[model samples]
Target: MTSVQQRTLYQWFEESALRQPDHPALEVGDEVLSFAGLRALAMTLAERIVHKHGRAPRRVALVASRTVAAYAGYLAAQRLGAGIVPLNPDHPDQRNLDIAQRAGVEVALVGGRSAGLFARLPERHRPTVLELDEDERADGPVPEGTPPAAYDLDGEAYLLFTSGSTGQPKGVPILHRHISPYLAHNITRYGITPGTRLSQVFGLTFDAHVFDLFATWGGGGTLVVPSATDLYSPVDFIVERRLTHWFSVPSVVREAQRLGNLPLGRAVTLRHSLFGAEPVTAQHVALWREVAPASQIHNVYGPTELAICCTNHRLTGPSARWPQYPGGTVPIGVMFPHMEGVLLGGDGLPADEGELCVRGPQRFDGYLDPRENAGRFLSYEDGGRAVAYDGSAPLTDRHWYRTGDRVRRVDGVMVHCGRLDQQVKVRGHRVEIGEVEAVLRRHPYVVDVAVAALPTDDGETELVAAYAGRAVDPAVFEAWLGDQVPLHMVPARIRRLDGLPLNDNGKTDRNALARILATREGS
Candidate 1:
């Protein structure tokens, strides 16, 4: 029923290369790499790596920006069966270096953009750096005794670090086994074909990038990457490239709508549109429908801990027909057939509203640090699932991962209620920041909004709202919002900007907003 039968990620690409060697695999601006071309380049780099190191290094780290070198380096490392640790060039140098050291990196594949940065690292801290050239070609025949492709589906594939609340980055190891089925399911579900053109909007650091890269390649489709300029004007980029599949964070939709760029009867080439990483509001979905009338829109949901997205709700028709969840966003829908999910209330028993617990074929085993597993999982035995998670209980593979996300089933569809930790005690009342943000986004002029419960130096927490749009009078907006919601729910401070700052993953930068608010308070 499906064309994708590869055991590993590299194998998927290799099969695509074999099936349609001349088919366009990657495109950025005028540059294009056919399946055969990309495979040849990656293999050539892998062969060179074997020659230099006598064998494949155990772990390879590379600056994971969206570039030809980054893509090639990833394939080369996979071809060598070496686990990859992608270093975010945009992240702080110390953080990247810390992750590199922590992951026990043996080699570094330096991209042209990050060569200088890697070059300046202290000698003791630096690994063996192999510079990758975008224009380099395979010079001669394969070197004698060139090592064979060694990737195993069960082995570690890549290491991704997510920002931790404790000021340290948490490392999550996504294995080939975890993602192989994920890629296959999406390729078939999304109806990807050789001629299908998908957008690559997420950076290498984010897990969504995994979907952008493999979903297209796995199904023998073309991957269209937009330049930084193109991202600011997504409608123009979508039209110019004639992208058939569009995927991005919901914020991009809001941004496009704010600029008045999403007019009706445009973006006709899009066949499947997917958005995740943040809540999708009704207004945003309506705007997207007008722009991409022919596309089937879906609001997918998952955490970085899970591979790509675990669940999605497809819009059957226009935005007005889209189901709205209690949190004021679209429903996230049911779990994929390959996974199982259970909701446990505060009492740790199955409830209509509770934290989501997931475990199945695609579920990740654990985090890099065993200690981080504390209280993050639920264990049960012999098919008897527990109603509540007991922190003192013993752990095993049978345990379900505590997603930390609260949700409820509305009309048999899962509706996200925001993160369990996102709930803040405001004046002894529990307030979900997501709830405030959702309501603010519904305002006529508010295109994008971010809410933060910033703590002042005096041990007081202030609810601050940062938004981007044409609503000039913050006082009027706040007063109107107060009339709509409870008094405590209204943001104490409103800061309006031309646009909300986005992090590398394209999510609204809450930390950046908190810092801006703190600075104004002279903290």
Candidate 2:
């Protein structure tokens, strides 16, 4: 029997181990581990962690390369009731510190060959770092015995630092209660009852990984974690692993189709392909039809504040093309039944088309940054905290997370528009316009700057930065920026502006920037 307090995650791990001991749990190029072996490794690492952290659930900073040990550490952290704060391995050493400090990670879990890098970090950001000896893989003394575990769910599950509208990195705390329901919902929704084979292509930091992980294990499904190389090289990896289900970004599907790298000519045996993170454009749909036409392709939609997939749209037939979701609003199907949503206008009252406010079983408690949390969640009975009722007091205690998205409610269907906040969704990651502007302003030649996210094709959003500088070459500044920010965070297009256009309130006029871009495009 599984302990209810252990959360469904623990039970899933044990169940997968018992039923499919020899089934491969992770496949990274030449490396492979059976389900039983992976679970045992997770258990050994979790015990090692508890001993190092003094048997308490403390938020731990985990840094590792894109491989199996990284996967193991993530599950181990969860088993010990500790939230996982994943530091992107590619990020500059110093930049990682700023986020680590902000998230208040008490210890750093270093894995794989980079195990020694933790000690090199600056004191301020470097907590008491712990390096696991699992890389050795040598068997420990004594026969395998069931050891006591200290898994708790009430603690923070993960601390995700998202770019705030003001260039400040805001920390969101994902709690177990917030994630548990979605796990249960998707497990039943996708029918991952038992002996199911699942694939994991996304990076662990992404919220999609939660769905990929839980939906598989909670219902006794076998997980297959593919390496980054194997992710793009689909056939050798997919066919060899005999993958049955996968959750992938649209870009991967398109790239695979373009390269003819998939076994799409008929041998493809995908049961279902889940896609999300950004808009699923028509260009991406064509790729879906080409490669895995027989598989059920589902477009998932949900913000990180909510659990992985709050809503999904499954393509019913194989179509050569898809209608682009029109601008003003695009229906993301309906709520998960367990989840509910409402469209509210500026007055804090319900409206046919306005702000997208969500209430559901998957709603997160609040952000790690409490001040931001107050603004994100509210009781519909009470005035939404995001809007100052101008002067009206709040109504109730049921919490709701403000999606910060522009959505319209038409005939009971929620239509997603653009965002109301200065946020950008590039690829699948959220980039705060303010953060990019701040970094641009840091350039010695830069005097003023503004950044914008223009929606584009293939579910991909483009990032363009407009800045006024000291008459220096834009390429020089762009190259300098590459050293400071992650490659993904770098602006794709850079334009030198004489000065940023500002409105009366001392805010940059984004409309003017859009108009300028439009005028240029037209010319």
Candidate 3:
């Protein structure tokens, strides 16, 4: 009997393709890659990797350009029983190489623009690069000599890098078992079946990508990838692709609303839009309700460690915002079937406001590189005499991914308060205090930096960055950052502090930083 560990992702995908070869599996612009087409591409690539590299859990970093092609190479790596790492093309060239090296990446697959950057990395750290371009269009057969490593269900599927407050990137592992529940959960919750067509708008590295791919496959639905330009523009490809479901960060939907480009009523094919990756304000929900009255708008709430989503709040008529929201009905929603959500109090007991801890099938078991960094969790107990209790109750359910987020629990619904740590939510995206510091400290003029999240007057989110530098051209520094990071990652309010405020423990005091933001807003 081939052990479960021997059943690699490629083997699973190839089997799926053979089982339903004609099904439309991926749609990118006018190009559609069927299950069979994707399988063939992945298989040929996997065979090539095996024939050349003699694969043995070799880490393959994919610099995805075309969303569909990226997905293809990712699947190919999985088939080879190799670990897959997806790099953001937007990351600074040095930052990208640093991350890839940290993950022990031995081979890299990237697009044309990303190609030149990887070549600059030192030879010892640089991996064999695979470029995905129009030229790689030759569809070849999988050779008979290929040695496909047996898939291990217990083996890691991929590594997702998270910037912690320590100003370092940690790789989180997603095993096969961690990926399966998404398929099953969405299939039950979203009615995902092979007949459905789901929209993919968010980045592949984003938490939502797990559901974006698995839900479609689990329900036997087609996964559609929109063109990068069309996605950024005021365009809706739902009708063109005959997509029955859509899921993305609320920003994309908001963009459509701002541009008056939505076809909600006339293009009534969409069944739902699961919005996450940021907080959805009442105003954001109402806009969707105004347009997609027929299509369900679901609020998905979950951290990256929790797979993709652990709960949902389906949008109906804008419920009365409560003290928290307009009607207080703005909810993080109920926990998924297999999850337990506990809203703890400051003392670590059940408080209306405290840290939200999630435990269930979706919660990622552990990080590939574990950091016992005392930051991600809130071990209640205000520091007990026993030394184990942090003056809080011990979690009774299971191992909790102490989401350093502050939220108010209302009748079991978790309402986000902000952060339990310096981590801030800017424009609905989680911005680590450490990520900005990591970037800023790398600048030649910078001695140190402190990044914080501030609220804009429109009641929207923005970032407040504080840096200590040796007096360089301010405009030049700003311009340098603009070229390196995603536009959203840039801090809105830059305030240089003499030094980051540290607590007695020599750790950045997030509470103090939050006070700074509040004081700045007051002024």
Candidate 4:
């Protein structure tokens, strides 16, 4: 096998196809595609893209999800040496169009129910749309005179848009060089082999989906995609598919428990169970263990900027022996051996508990918009004061990407305290919303809880909590919370909800929760 450093992202899949042409590469909705079959489909689609655009495009928009076109289009873009921009079909039409325009997409490969989405885009804003049906057929063997592999390791592989604090989506372009090492590490770490079957739980827009596709394809593993119904009942889906690996946000566990589908030892086939994109609570780990007793459970952590994930903590011993943290959340563990991590306190000095800053091979260069780079990176001077990158100079490898997530070292392991933005000032005393949410989660009737700091009519900031589970007396819950936390930390109002709303990435949507709470406050 070629060293990962010597190959581009496309080479990962190409090499696997050559090694296991007949192996099942993807299983989506009653259709199974072999490595050879999927590779040929990607070649055919690449040829069509070049013919339509008169040359290899600079960027391609994959406006689809959970369909053949979505996976094939991704490979097709890599073959053409074009950076991919994955637009979600479920996203608002205007939002998709905005991302396409910002990415300078030359062509769009539409699939499933998203054909209408592309049609709705104004012609001027729309890229050259190629409507690919869900049942698009693959071509025969590769032709004699196929275009040579056009991608370079240093070139951008995929561009993703994440919500920015400035109200507009920020484009994060990850180069092939940045992701190759990540794929190499995780494929070996997770023991992905030709027979390994992994569940595809994340959407194309989420950065984690990159691991679902490339890592599995890179290792010749089979990717089994779940449908909407399948996601609602993951235990049954895992059992039916015989999946060996599973990865999704921690919220899915709550959903499975809510539906009463999490039976003990049902998903016996799983070997690796990974949860990320949000904190993993002890309750979540306990319930998942009941379902997959033999599986090696890990709590992985990373932001989109760090390539899929940079840190992980595997629960090795019995459930009773696992280390417990203050918030009942699993530790994020140490940074990957290859990366460097430092916690910077409020005074810009290293501390035991503060914002985490990291730098390594897997870290991206900078945001596509240079302006967004301001204050996102940090540089140390004389090993003393931490200086934030002001976007005045070129972003170098020496700069550490400020994660904006506060973390604390507990008994030599790093525990996620929550986002720095999650801390708010209430009556001149700083409060971390996660601490309150963690306390509320202890309530027997609370399946999930989200704490948001909102302004009252009196111009004072107060914590507002929204909880989901069985109905509980607000007075009783408040009394219970009062006993668990400081008086200022107790929520000014507690609201009951059927379920906490989730964003596109499946993380609890604190912004949306704030709006919901604000509406009640105004009432």
Candidate 5:
């Protein structure tokens, strides 16, 4: 029997392969790779890495998208006990190079489409490139005694880069122990089995992809990859792929509703549907239920610092029975059984509504840059006052990670409010942007909306809104909005767009909307 300390992320897939060698493990378009087949490919790639570097690298970069190289390369890195660093081909070359340099990536695995992108890397910071063709051919077997120790629970599994407030990317490294419990809990919670088929909608750059990969592989299930078009029409993909499980950002549901692509009760094969990385509205759930009538709907919430997700809410019974909260969004439910959470008020005291702080097995140790850890954690005193961690002492599990998002407890369930930073002052009145957006979404003509506070020439901030749906007269909409909320919440300028811009993670890009509003204000 494998001890808990001897478990690695790669061991999950290896176990599935031994149990069900012929089971279909991955489905990329028409190509389906069985568990045994994928294991062989990963072994071949791992051998290539060892042969090129004379040993397994400490970190490897994956510059591929939804290609076979991406999936196989991920497993290959795990097999060699190397930390995986996934790069986006769509990002600027300098940005990707900066990530590679920061992570100290020794080798890069490139797919056919990303070959040009990898070539753009300067030799000074560029890793040794292994161009994987579409055929996925292997050169030779790995020499004996080349592979490193396969199991190390404390070893770093992967390193991810997220946008920082300082105009740079912050590195977050997740260890195998930190993520093992997450995978174990979800695989059983979702009823994953060899017959289950899961959807892979998130890109490698997003942390949500961690669930799409390990959870499915660990349970001996199939991971079905979708194409670019499939994302816009997910209902069609769900029916065609015969997927039993589906997960993506809530924006996909809104886009499908806007495009009229969700047919009534068409996704009969799906058993579970999950939405996260953004707040989910009741309307999104209602529309999705119309299509996947028999599927269990869930809204999961978490930050990258807390693994994939720390809390989840399942919508059971009818729509009327579902818990409705302020901001017209679904409840975030409770924290996982293995974790503990507390809400801190503005005065650093315990409260029913405030910043959510958590501490548990799933919480990461700290950011890659020690400087980024300042003020990101909290230590509770005997009197229950939360003190901000100033890095005066060694960081320990006793400290709780401060998730910047605000939430309130309703009927013992946590409901997400807007982020603390999203609370902006307009004419000396603090207004929550999510509250404004929630009100705007009530209008029959509005499908999706994003409200931003932009700077004015007079050095004051004002509200501006960009909405996607039917074009309505701005004056009429503003008057209707003013009647519902205070006058300050109303936007000074309203713009109608065919659709709101989405970031790589499929969430509404508020920064891009702010830029657009600023540019239009100048124009």
Candidate 6:
């Protein structure tokens, strides 16, 4: 039996491919790629890449998705020890080009009809583009010779760009060592096997896709890819494909419930259900459990810097009760066995309610830019006290990465509170934007909500709440909101919308909402 510490991600994928060469590895619609077939296709592409670039390219950008070539190109990059920079073809041309330039990519594999995406990039900033042919199936037999060891455990594996507070995209470089343990832990913990059919619904840019790709391939399970339409009606897709594993953000569950897609008592083949990337509320879990009663519900939590997820809280059975936290969300549970964690209050000491900090083998070294590392880590002293974080000194492995997420122990389990930055003062009273959002979401008529601090004409900050749900009079909702919370915590403004705007990664776009408020104020 393979242990969690035994192999790297690529090694595990190779072993799975070799062990089950004829098993189904990747699937989309009616198309399926056997392990042997996908490996052969990847090797052919790897050979072509070596021929063009002489040596393995340092980094490769993939402008494709929902195709065999995309997965093959990803494996090809791994075979060459090149880091991957995924460029979503559906995203704006400028965004894709920016990512390509920021990652310093040497080549980009344009899959399917996405070749035109690279043409928009200026000649000076563009990497060498290789477009995939219309037919992506492997035509030749498996390659004979074994590829050489080109990747180191410490080498960069992928570069993911997350939106920064400064309005620019920050690159998060994850190394091979940081990801191997994550993959191993998930595969073993989820009991993934050759028979397990996992869902791949997240976009390539979202960090959650990391679990979708490696966890399936590493455990020799089949990765079931869904079309854009499948996402709107995920329950149908899950039922049709008989998927054994389900993983996505809680928003998907809420969407399904809203659309009347989650029919009660509809049995599913899912054995493990996981949600991450946002707070998972008990209401969302109840909806999920009602649909898939046999599957174990788990709320996984982590940031991109800590790999796919650092902790998970599992509900044993459908009848099992869910524990609610202070923020009206599910408890995030304890840290994974391979990770270390601490919660530090504003005073820089360990506290029951504070910012969560972590340091372990799964933790990445630092951001791509040294400047972005400022105040992102903290030194710790005796008694697990976090010392001051010096922006002047270079960050080292000894420093704990500050996650910026506030958490508290609730009934012996760590529960997510909100982002530390979400705190804002109104009339000398501190209010958390997330707390307001959480409170509003509990309303029977409210489906989704977001609260932002917008400046008033009087040079003071006002709490503005935007929500999407059944139609109701604004005055009535405002009066009802006031009765539920303190006057200072109540929103000064309430705006109703058809739905909360979501970013490319599917999280609520608070910045976009703030812009709407600012536009209304100007008018």
Model 3 residue runs over 4 Å out of place are 1-15, 138-142, 233-235, 316-329, 373-397, 442-449, 457-459, 468-471, 482-486, 493-523
- lDDT per model vs. reference: 0.77, 0.68, 0.68, 0.84, 0.83, 0.80
Candidate 5: stretches off by over 4 Å: 1-6, 116-124, 137-149, 422-522
Candidate 4 — which residues are off by over 4 angstroms? 1-6, 116-125, 422-522
Name the 10 consecutive residues with the lowest summed lDDT in model 1. 380-389
Model 2 agreement with the true structure over 1-523: per-residue lDDT tens digits = 1112236455556666677677666655567777676677777677666667666447877787656666677777776667778887677666777777787777777765656665676666567666754452415531243245444566677777777765667777777766777776677767785556788877766777777776676677667777667767765666677777878776776666667676554427677777787666655655556666677777778888786667776664566444445552235667777777777788788877777788765677665655665566555754443443211344232556788777765555555777788776776787878888888788887788887776555346777778776665657766788877767678877887777788999888988886675445311
Best by TM-score: 2
- Worst 10-residue lDDT window, candidate 2: 388-397
Candidates sorted by TM-score, descending order? 2, 3, 4, 5, 6, 1
TM-score of each: 0.79, 0.87, 0.85, 0.82, 0.81, 0.81
Give lDDT tens digits, candidate 5, residues 1-523: 1222235789988899889999999999989988988887888888888888778888989988887767988999999999899987765566687788889899988877677665676767667888877778444443454475478888888899865555356788999998888888889889999999999998897888989999999989999999999988999999999999999987676667668777778998988999887677787888788889889999999888898899999986567777668988899999988888999999999889999999888899999888889899999855778899998787899999998889999998999986787666564334667777877888999999998988676435689999999998989998888766556668899889888889999999988989888786421
Q: For residues 192-232, write the lDDT of model 6, one tens digit per residue.
A: 99999999988777778888988899999999998977877
Give residue 521's error in model 2 in angstroms. 10
- Clash totals in order: 3, 6, 31, 0, 0, 0
| Model 4 alpha-carbon miss at residue 212, Å | 0.6
lDDT by residue for model 3 (1-523), tens: 1111223345545655777888988877677788878777777776766666656446788887655667878777887777788888876676677788888888888887887867787777668787776335325554565564556776677777876555667777777666666555667778876789888776766656767775676456788888766765423576667778888777776666667676555546767867776777777766666556567778878877877777887765443433345242257777777676766656557666777877666567666554432344433333431122232343333456677667776665667766666676665566676777787777886776766666665556777766666665556767787765656677765655667678999977766876775686421
In TM-score terms, candidate 5 sits at 0.81
- What does the lDDT read for residue 318 in candidate 3? 43
lDDT of 4 at 150: 79
Q: Which window of 10 residues has the lowest lDDT sum in candidate 3?
A: 382-391
Residue-level error in angstroms, candidate 6, position 251: 1.1
- TM-score for predicted model 1 compared with the true structure: 0.79
Question: Model 6 misses residue 184 by how many Å?
Answer: 0.9
RMSDs, each prediction? 10.6, 4.1, 4.9, 10.4, 10.6, 10.4
